[model samples]
Target chain A: MSAAVPSMPGTRRFALLRHGRLLTGAILTGALVAVALLSLLWTPEVPTRLRILAKLKPPLSEGLLGTDQLGRDILSLLMVGTANSLSIAVAAVVLGAATGTLIGIVAAMRRGALDALLMRMMDAVFAFPPILSAMMLSALLGSGRLNATVAIGLFTVPVFARLARADTKRILRRDYILAARGAGKNAARIAVDHVLPNIAGAILVQVTIQLGLAILTESGLGFLGLSISPPAPSLGRMLADAQTYLTLAPWMALAPGITIALIVAGFNLLGDGLRDRLDVRRDVSA
Target chain B: MSPLLDIRGLSKRHPPRGFGRGAGVLALDDISLTVEAGSIHGLVGESGSGKSTLARIVMGFDRPDSGTVLLGGVDVQSASGEALTKVRRQMQMVFQDPGGSLDPRQRIWKTVAEPMGLLEPRLARLQRREKVDALLASVGLQPADGDRFPHEFSGGQRQRIAIARALSTNASLIIADEPTSALDLIVQAQVLNLLMDLQETRGLAILFISHDLAVVAALADTVSILHRGRIVETGRTGEVFARPQSAVTAALLEQDAVSLASTDQLKEKIHYPR
Candidate 1:
């Protein structure tokens, strides 16, 4: 057999071309992040303050992007709304992915009764939609962004658990894991050193997709009056508030609606791109 | 001296499916073998002949229904936690598929040095790298090649990396389960020669399990022929090869002759470097 050779120059170039969609997704996600970060320090007008005379003013009039039904600045609300939605989505995704992946790894490592129990628990969670759970949680815990985040995060646990469990099981079957076991590495070491790294790519892709779902769920809860209370700007609440003034102030609904769509689309594209790049089988074939 | 690995009256049966109405199939039946330190004990058997089952039981990966596995004088089945880890540190295994044996995502250095990290745990990163380089060199792989991933190397090179990993802990006994079965005939010989060199230098006891009798004939000192979970014959390599005892042995020898002849023809067609 021949000595080790470096990967082909063409292969590197092909990888870049293959992940072009990832670059586009990153750009989209980055722009939204920038808007959210920009909102933290400054906005043209106060999001919550009312100016009665400027109610339902057209875009570029009394305030940029005009005023809403409460005569609150649409531009400011949209900026702050972006921040709120992004933060909640990030928190939920982190919470769900971390806990769910741990559960999944445990299930995969200890098969039989534990595996069945964890999966059944996930199935039970799967029975109720995220929105339904969020509504129940909102009623029980009192309506706010924290409760909404917790509810949505809990909903994503089962998804992450199933994905992590399947990926871990596949990795456990590899001979390297057997070799590690033979090498005197215990279950925890095997999981951390071997199983986790191999399955991280799959989990990462799932995380991005779950972020999109979390954002969507958060907005749905807000629209239904089960999310963050009024006076604080929320994209979904803004959409709900603007529904009555469809003719007089269509921009009110248009701004938040378009923002939610863009954020979700960005995350979905990013997730798809990550799946393509992280697919080990594709790398093996290449 | 006591054997490096000793199995006595080892038997394992898989439970029958469908509410366990029927009797379970015996994977290994009353099997017993011993590998002396610094000697190679070849376990030869065809597929479904329990060679792998024997390897797994000896490695403590699976428990036997009835028998004891003593590795380096420690009972493998009875040991637990830190004791089991200590016992395992004295033994390592080379799997059948070299490609699947090493993690594709890990660099050669990390893969080679993994056992050392697990067993010793206190070795500094630099020291581990030095040991990894030395291990790679011992396996005839360039020290610089340790930076590359497993996929970047040829099958033989990967197998060498696997060997390097197995040798990391400086184990007294190595269970090589068909280690050379995946490579070309010429490469297979090179790997076998490498194993022999390691065995001689380190005085390693090797349990070489393989389906090919010809391959075992080259390296094994004491040979055990298995058929359908039972040992058909056990003797010195020369005696087993020279004599005709069991029908299973005769059939296996005849099969090896046919395959060896075909291999010789193939070796001639393609000019392989010695």
Candidate 2:
């Protein structure tokens, strides 16, 4: 039950399959994940191999999508970059959501002094500008995707915590929760049977939104040379390397730029669509 | 045996708003009552007459400032662990708003089976399922109806589901706090009739709380009239109405006179506009 509601499984799937926003988002995000997973198998050419003679050769002149300033295949680099970008986002969001949701549930259940202290701490965490702190965090931790993911994950804590805690508190006041208690279920039992299920929809929506944010933030770090060094490739790093060439080679930025835009938009659409579906059902039941 | 349920010297004060300074409102003032086994004890009161506060205290959802609630000779206020569980199992409750009481997210069977699940954990899963079906049937609902959600039911059906849940644990006493207040006239009579039937069949006791004297007068064996936070008059239903000693009781009788027929009003000194 989501406080006491069971998971909305198959019912939403077929109905939502016909939805434009959800379909487009599913296709785009699905493509992103598929491309990332596909990277393990193949790419057009060796992404790290530098063809000195083919440097700045532009699209279609040689390999498809042409080459970067270093003469590496842009298509291959983009293919590998999806894996790098997605892994960082997924890992960071999962870590943050799990930790933050637990803290939020605890804060709500405990209430009083502990709740005040926990919520105030979350407020403090929220006050810190996410991008700047993530920048400093990755920079201090040295170079690597883990450093950036960890940094982004840490900052995401407050958002999920606030969401979970607020939802739990609201659902706790419901007569069913009281009825559950009267039925001989303890505080923890009600939390598992009622609180978690009811708060889940909100949490799921937040997680989707945060996945997009994490990707954006981690890319920002990579743009600053904080993640995915050398041949590993990163979309943000590709954009960074392309910026210098600018007028000389505008096509260098196109591939990575378009990919990032599509992925972020995909996540936003999916989150919004899920929220709409949840709202409609809630109104019906209400 | 002592009464199935008993409350002695129960008191509660709702603290004032904002920093909680100054004197608080006395929601219940040293109230005491008893519900004999297989009898209906109606708590009659106006809107602010501490009916809900006393219900909460007796249900052990909220602690009384000073009092002891004995359910079958066990002190509910201080019972803990297994004793607490037993107290919870023996004394079940039905709320005013059936919609609010049943979890909209849960299926009817699960809600009805919850108390049984807790109290009879050792019973086989299949046996529990059978029990749930039996409980649903006992409430005049089809067993298949148990698969549906609360949103799928009418107000009367929801109240029936709530009653089914109360009966699931084989509770000796059901604290029905305004169980019919949210229902329409016909449905209220049906649910009251259902309660009377359940008490008849199971030999259970009921602490029926309500704001309407006519409703109480029709069902309760014993009645207590509460005003503000104190019980102004109480006795066998017939005796109390025959001679109301308190002005508050007189007012309740007068207010409830609207529902009574012209003939009955002559003896009670009440007149109904035809």
Candidate 3:
């Protein structure tokens, strides 16, 4: 039987690439990832520099996007700051997905005491809102970017663990899984060979969605004065700093606020696109 | 002649505790059957008839509540890890729904070569590919088909690929669970014919499970009818078709007999048939 894939005005590739939301989101996310990776190598100015001379100079000759309240060029500060925020978000997502995927697999494979323990632990972790937990953690450890990153990363562990466990539970029940077990494969091999491959698409979709959520959460922490100390030029911190000079130059608060909104919206779009692409339900119509 | 596979009093019962609690459902009752070497025996039953359960028990995939499955007269129920592995090598299965049976991400070559990996270690990678190609060709599939993923092929082609995968292991017996049910009628006939041809050429004992009586009639030498977890009747394919004793068997033989609203006529036919 032939499938019925809906045809649009333009080709599928053209529609996907030319779409402003998808393209812009992809480009922005790609740029952010690249900048984050490259930050290990170089920065235009020492990120810690605090000079009053260059402070608050509007976007002009030497200072692109103007200097922040702390005299660092807003553009350079943003580049490194974007990298730092993204680094934490990416790490948290990866760590959370990996750990959660493992726990989910283990729970699915051996569903008795271990399953109960892991599930209860996940439930307990899920009991608290991630932001609240992060706030509590930052308050205890004092504020720092690393603390926020680690807190956000830790908070995400249960989210993934729950998704992975739920997805894996359903996947393990499929006929092919039964077929693999029939072939005399042990639990470990079946998990690795059969369960993991099938669940990967679902895992990928979840990771993308979680990536967006992670970014939003990290920015939220920075906005709450619980992350990146002071003068780090974080998007949230920049917005906080711009509040004092809101009437003088509304661009200060608006720029960083809009940047955060755009980045978050981009990640959200990318996640949605990925979900549509990776989902098995889409192929049923195809 | 001694039977190649003998199952005695195989009974599997679902515990009456879940959603359908308090209503005891017998998935498989005291059912027994013998499959001769180099023969194609078909087990026919409707949905929820426990034919699949029987296949699973035979293949060591499920543990029966009470029964003994003897493969080549060796008890498979008590078979340990390595013993189960050995049993698996002796008999492989080609599952229903070929698309679901094969891993979507794995290429056909790797899928075919996998069964051989655990059994035949000395078979080099290239040799395995060559053998896989030959196996595919035997099942009316092209060697190039092995490079593509499962989703790349049609339902019929995917079943042929699955048959090729089963053949790669060189097992003595094949438990084909509704191997052709998912295909179109024309494709189903082709796959059935292929199984018959393979059975004749290789002397492989096949335990074919299907819901279609007509399909079983075409290929199975012996036929067993299972109803609600019990083997109601079994005989030579022609004999069972000619003179089915049990009401379940008669309902199976006469088309539309099952869908008849009244059980009175069915009971009469079983108790006293013309």
Candidate 4:
């Protein structure tokens, strides 16, 4: 797979430029982030300002992407929605990856009883349907952005924990770990110093993949009216708003629907690209 | 004075394959050996002869069923906490594959300085860097080489880094488990020379384990021939190779000769030694 990556730094750069998935993904993701940032400062109209007369206006009739059922600018709502989605996804992923990776490594290092206990608990959580857990969390936390975040974040923990554990165990079997012990460094020190750095590639890839999933899961919750309570715009909320007027004003669904698709697709491609670039080099420990 | 490394009656048995302690393979059987303060000792065996098991036990990573491994006169098995940590500093190990032993993600200097950071906690960062540079120099690597990762270096260079790491704690003994078997003969010769150099300059003792009898014959001062978990023969390196007493010894020497004769045949086919 290193064949996909050139040996020379100069050639690597040239090859990276030619990587279509990475390039397109970067552009799409970059535009989404940029629009999210811009939404903080300005948009054509206040996303939540109601103007019932303009409701269900077709694209470019009143505002750039026209108005939704609530008569808020579709473009503005979608922009703010992008920002909200990104923040929620970021918070959830960080929470999940940190807690999960810690537990995973601890389980990996301890093994036997502790490993079984931690992993079985994680398995119980992991086996539960993610959407159900989100709904349950929304119920418990009382339906807001933090509730959505907590639900998505808690759901990601088992995913990251399982990845970190499996990868840590694999790395523990490596000769460098044995050499680390021979260096008079104990297991804890080796786990931090040696195992962490080696598993970084896998973690990074997992982080990117989870990020995309977080956005989707967050949007899904929003779609179910379990996220960021209405009047606060979201892509899923916008979709939900577009539902009643679908036949008469199909354009209402198109803008937020397309934007969400592009963002998710961009993140998936970026994750794939990173995996290709950061491929493990075939573990030359032969 | 006690030998730098003295292992006595070391035996290890692996638990049986299936459930129930049916029976275990005798991985090591009453193995005993010693290396003087400034000498090289070789442990030679075929793959399943428990060479690695002995190395593992000697390094205190694994327990022997019943034995004592004394490094710098402290019994490793009995040593605890500070004592065990201190004794660990006195002996270091080099594994068979340089690629496998060196952390690919770690810079070479950090790899070399690892033992020192653990054993010498008070060492200042600046002092550590200087000492690491000197260690790299001693191993015939450029000081700048420490900035690079292990994957950037060739196999020979990685072994040198491993040796430098072994030397970092000012270790009296290094248990090298096939340290050069992964390298080509030319690079192997260079690495062997480096080991010999360390032994002479620092009075470092090495417990060099390898299946290459020729390498042992060249490097070891005292040699032990391990066969099926037992040390079948022991003597001065020259005397052992010159006059083999045990059947295993004779057979090994014969095997060595056959390998050499095959090399000659290879050369003849090539038309020139070069």
**Structural similarity to truth (TM-score) of each candidate:** 0.92, 0.91, 0.88, 0.93
Better of 2 and 3 by TM-score: 2
User: Model 2: how far is B114 from its true place, Å?
Assistant: 1.1
**Worst window of 10 by summed lDDT in candidate 4 chain B:** B265-274
Q: Per-residue alpha-carbon lDDT of model 4 for B142-168, expressed as tens digits?
A: 999989988788889888988999899
Between prediction 1 and prediction 3, which has the larger TM-score?
A: 1
Report RMSD (Å) for each prediction in the order shown: 4.6, 6.4, 5.9, 4.6
lDDT of 4 by residue, A10-30 (tens): 877777675877778888899
Ten consecutive residues with minimal summed lDDT in candidate 1 chain A?
A: A277-286
Candidate with the larger lDDT of 1 and 4: 1
Docking class for candidate 4: medium
Q: Give the CAPRI rating of model 3.
A: acceptable
**Candidate 3 lDDT for residue A182:** 57
Evaluated against the true structure, the overall lDDT of model 2 is 0.84
In candidate 3 chain B, what residue range of length 10 has the lowest lDDT sum?
B265-274
Stretches of model 1 off by over 4 angstroms after superposition? A1-18, A282-286, B81-83, B117-119, B262-274
Residue-level lDDT for B93 in candidate 2: 91
Off by over 4 Å in 2: A1-18, A281-286, B260-274
Q: 3 or 4, which is superior by TM-score?
A: 4
Docking class of 1: acceptable
- Write the residue-wise lDDT of candidate 1 on A1-286 in tens digits: 2235456667778878668778877889999999999999999987899988879988988677989988999999999998998999999999999999999999999999999999999999989998999888877999998998899899989998999999899888888998988877789989998889888999999999888888888899889988888888899899999999989899999999999998999998898898997885622311
Q: What is the C-alpha lDDT of each candidate?
A: 0.87, 0.84, 0.77, 0.86
lDDT of 3 at A60: 66
Best by TM-score: 4
